[model samples]
Target: MPEPLQIGVVVFPKVTQLDLTGPVQVFSSVPGARVHLIWKRIEPVPSDSVLVLTPTITFADCPQLDVICVPGGGGSDDMVNDEEMLDFLRRQAGAAKYITSVCTGSLVLGAAGLLQGYRATTHWSAMDHLAPFGAIPAKTRVCVDRNRVTGGGVTAGIDFALTLVSLLIDRQTAEAIQLRLEYNPAPPFNAGSPDTAPPEILAFMKERIAPFRQRRSEAIGRAAARLG
Candidate 1:
């Protein structure tokens, strides 16, 4: 029998639950795949929302994984400057077939120096932070650069996972999984992105997230300096 495909998703305090859970849900459908929720410890971690996620394995005991994914949220601000977290990611990137992230998780990859010269994407609000880590930011929802795959924003994780599924297995399998999940998206409103949202709504969102953007920018600066 073939060995199980090991996939590890990093979990941390303040993670955007959807960012981690969406891809996990898709990955779980892959035949012979073992998905692990990883963290510094095997304990509960609170997300940006009310959700609480528990890590299945501690970072110290995590097995070599076929794929390693990082999901982003406000918590990423702390991780960008965290040597321990960055070190773990760097070690995993050495042998992992794919290094991927969802939402602001790409920022964590960038912090770890894993994304140097890779074309990647992150949450729209944090796109500008990519260049500091030597990543070429793409405007698309999912950006794939060789072995590096990054998804934009939270909801995009599902789309990103399906894309990765196609590469890992086959388009036929990915399509079947998509159908099984009934993954068609038809939002009641067209206010998903800044470009498509009404001017007022966009302005309001930009204003609302200004503090977070500023904090992330500072963290990016520190992470880049450390890389240098």
Candidate 2:
């Protein structure tokens, strides 16, 4: 039998814990699949004030991967402005057979100049930033264009990873994994998307996240200027 496909997942300080753990759970379920938590260095990284995870491989230690996935959250604003990290993402993603992102990770990819002319999606609040990077912002929870794949906000990572499993392996396997996890979602709230969200809720969220949005916007502008 052929060897299991090797995958690398990049994790950094302040990445949403769910973004990393969700995909890890799905991809690891695939038969003969191996996933490594790759990082700029081999050390414990903290996410949110409570969660800290140790890396399985460092930049110099990672093996070439069939897939490389990056998950993002609050750290995205900083990452988009980081030359070293953006360059590393560009180099690693350029060589991977499939490069994927969850949530604001798409912004990092865009900042790295990998998403130019690609169709991608990111957290809805930050979707507008895609224009500077020359990517068409997709409204879907998951968007795949050639080797690049991106997902919407936090919860969408699970769905996106399941879709990837189906693409790489088979639909049956994906369904089985979903079934095992009871992936049938039941949300008490009806407003998941911008179009469906109540005006007040949307306004509140937008207002609350304004500072972060501004930082990311500024970062994207700088990245675009550099690329230009």
Candidate 3:
């Protein structure tokens, strides 16, 4: 029998659970795919959405991965500067087939100094931080730059994972899985992005995340310097 496809996702405190879970669900559905939630500690980690997930393996024990994903959320602010986690990710990516992230998770990948010179995307709010890491930030929902794959925002993990299915397995398999999951998306409102939202709403939304943006900018600056 062929070896199972090994996938590892970094699970940390205060992750935006959807960013991790969405892709994980997709990956788990694929035949011969083994997904591992990895962390330095094996304890349960909390998310902003009231979900607590346990890690499947510690950093030292994780096998060489086919994919290494980082999911971002409120906790990413702290993770952006976590030297231990950054070092772990850096070492893992050295052997992984693909290096990836979702939403603010890209910021964490950036901290690990992984996205440099890659075309990548993150949650719109955190996109600007990519430049400091030598990343060529794209404005799309999903991007594949060489072996570096990235998805934007929380929900984009699904599409990104499906994209991975095509790359790792085959288009036929990915399509079948998408159909099995009924992956059609039809948002009720046309207000998902700044260009689609009204002026006042965009202003308000930007204001709401100003603090996070400022903090990310500062943290990424420091992380980028480490790569220098």
TM-score of each: 0.99, 0.95, 0.97
RMSD in angstroms, candidate 3? 1.0
Show model 3 residue runs off by greater than 4 Å: none
Worst 10 residues of 2 by lDDT: 86-95
Highest lDDT among the candidates is held by which one? 1
Query: lDDT tens string, model 2, 186-219?
Result: 9999899889999999999889988878887787
Q: Order of all candidates by TM-score, from best down to worst?
A: 1, 3, 2
RMSD of each: 0.6, 1.3, 1.0
What local lDDT does model 1 show for residue 26? 97
lDDT of each: 0.95, 0.87, 0.90
lDDT of 3: 0.90
